[model samples]
Target: MSSAAYERIRNNPKFDKLVATRSRFAWTLSAVVLILYYGFMAVVAFNPTLLASPLGEGRIATIGWPIAALMMLLFWVMTGLYVHRANGKFDEINAELIKEATKEAQ
Candidate 1:
């Protein structure tokens, strides 16, 4: 693409909003996942027994088992959410940006 095309997109307000919204959303998700993962790790580091200890008197499962499962589920959910939003809102803004840029180029 030409510099003019690039400039047109760069100057578009919707382009700025798209970048801002996508970046903020991505960073927020990253922060949440990091905090959850590291919070679990920190707990393990400080309290090893809490993770290893059985859930109850007769149960075979440990607390860590469910937590690990939840973490995996959280990762999947977050991924799905990001994909859904990107396919919807992000794509819409992107298409608008392209449409506007093409109009300007012509």
Candidate 2:
């Protein structure tokens, strides 16, 4: 709550590790989603017929439909993965840092 406590947390090595690890994970997930989305868009832009084509000889659905759905599901899974790690490992490290800082402040 105090500035000194904040400074103490900021100066902690665990705090730096937490920030670096979380940022790296977030960026990695972001890059994966971006690549998937943009790659799909590129396909749609350059090869519309490929995506537009039907899934099978008699199927009404296009191949792109399943691909898009899978991409959406994958994104959700990635989100869950991030949340799991954040709530687990990240939170543990954060709690430790906070407790340490508070103790040092006292």
* Candidate 1 residue 17 C-alpha distance from true site, Å: 0.7
Tens digits of per-residue lDDT for model 2, 1-106: 6999999999999999999999999999999999999999999999989998999999899999999999999999999999999999999999999999999977
**Clashes in each model (backbone N, CA, C under 3 Å)?**
0, 0
For residue 92, model 1's alpha carbon misses the true position, in angstroms, by 0.7
Question: Global lDDT of each model?
Answer: 0.92, 0.96
Q: Tell me, by TM-score, which candidate is best.
A: 1
Tell how far residue 14 is off in model 1, in angstroms: 0.6
Residue 11 accuracy (lDDT) in model 2:
93
TM-score of 2: 0.91
lDDT tens per residue, model 1, 55-103: 9998888989988998999899999999999999899999989899989
RMSD of each candidate relative to the true structure: 1.2, 1.4
